[model samples]
Target: MSDHVEEQEMEAEALEAIFDVSFSVVHDAQPFVWSVRLVPVDCGGDESEELEHNHVAVKLVATIPPTYPEDCGPELDVEIERGLAEQHREEILGVARDEADANEGMPAIFAVCEAVRGWLADNNEKGLEDVSMHAQMMRKKKDEERSKAKQEQKFESQKKAEEMTEAELEEIAVRKRRADGTPCTEENFLAWKEQFDKEMEEEAAREVAEREREGGSNKKKGAATEIKSRRDAEREGRPTGYELFSGKAGTMNLEALEAAAEEAEEGSDEDDAVTVEDLDVDENLFDDDDDLDDLDFDDDDCDEEEPEI
Candidate 1:
């Protein structure tokens, strides 16, 4: 037997053993013809549950030439018996042919079958991806349609308004009359009310802000005035109201005390002055041991004292 014929026979036997029932010999002559069903590689998933699942089983036909496995490769054709896209069928044929070409001077049936299977697997994955992309596109289309519907509704409303006759517009205004029998459009009441509410809120906010500002200013001013008054009283050597009321009257210097007593005497009228007899002291509130003679009097106290009117 010829070397090329032997090689072809060996390839046919190997393919039949590997593929079993799926492999068939059409002609067993000088130009041998056989077909092998090609199944794609497994894509790890429950493919039966997938919506975009596509399982490929292409029949690859090969014809061995006299120059097979030597100077030339086998003639190859693809038959999609189970059904596949024409584009994919052509692409599978191209891949098989390319594999055969690469295995020139060698048995290429197994390599060609594997190449076609790989192509089917890769294309199946791409189709699944395309399905995902299609879902996204559909979602986007729905959103656009909703938006368009809204716009169309608005356009229809405007068109209806434009198509209304003058009398129909008047009737609508009458039907929308307020409880006081005044049409809303007669004075643009809604617009005016909106503006009025906005202005009122702005005014109220301004008033609140003004009151807060003034209150803070007055508080600071009162605090500063109180502090300045205390400082002045201390520097001028005078009694503060707190000192007088809190039994700290002696805290005032003698000079300030004397000056204050003299000012009080000068401010008093003769009729308002009290004599010793004018005092209504009970005198019994004191103990019997208390005596007027025990009171110490300064020698110049009489000279400084005011005389009776």
Candidate 2:
């Protein structure tokens, strides 16, 4: 019975040792676990056809935890496993080293640590740094957008304020201008305003006109251009009307005038060429002369009596 109790204590010790190594490896590998075993092994070889056997053998098996996701529940577990593999490789190695040192010559513990290390190597986690960086960048972009919107809103408010101020100023000016007895109706105001506007427009027009007149008056006059009289023009050897009409009157050839006069004389001679034999003569012509001679005979006798008186 004591031998059985000793055996049971040995088993318990073995189990405790195994559990410690596995738990250490798992904790350091943070989310991975190791499976350990102890097996009998023969260490002594037969000589001369006799076989010598060793007492026991040990083996270790390990399975790395599945990678974790960045979400709740099982996914988080997987993510934890992966994160442990990548971020805590050194820690896992340290745990294996410590367990190996503590359980020197214990093949089961060594094998367990080796298996856990191998599992950790096989199951590496994706780095969370990249996700963190992306989140930071998004945050920065959102902040920038918010800042720009705020600035735009501020500028719009300022612009509206300025417009309101301008409107108030315009209203004040209108009110002040309307405070007088001037009627603001379409008919009465338009008539009175039309007269005032017409006067103002006329004054402006007169000012413009006066400016133009002053500008004209201030301009220097050019010298008076002398125009020659007809006589003066003639005295200056310029062309007269007859000279202009007759084509160089003094230079006309006498032969041309003689030819023209000869033409005229020829025309006259044509008229004078009528013969008296071709004409009818008046028959009373000798009687009219005889009557005039007979009346003239008493003139000398009346003149001699007047001379004696």
Q: Which one wins on lDDT?
A: 1
**Candidate 2 stretches greater than 4 Å from native:** 1-85, 107-309
Poorest 10 consecutive residues of model 1 by lDDT?
Answer: 122-131
Model 2 per-residue lDDT at 98: 55
lDDT (10s digit) by residue, model 2, range 186-300: 8987788889988999999999999998877665332122333544666887667766434354433333433444445456565554433333333344357766676543434
Q: Candidate 1 at residue 188, lDDT?
A: 91
Go through the candidates in order and give the C-alpha RMSD of each one to the true structure. Answer: 23.0, 34.7
Query: Global CA lDDT of candidate 2, please?
Result: 0.45
Residue range with the least summed lDDT across 10 consecutive positions in model 2: 69-78
Clashes of each: 0, 11
TM-score of 1: 0.37
Tens digits of per-residue lDDT for model 1, 1-309: 987788788988899888787789999998899898766643334456332455455789998888888888889999874436566678789999999989888889999988888876654433222335675587467669878999999999999989999999898887877434855584698789989999999999999999999999999999999999999878788766876534355432334434445545577765655443344334453457667667655545634655332
**Regions of model 1 farther than 4 Å from truth:** 41-54, 125-309
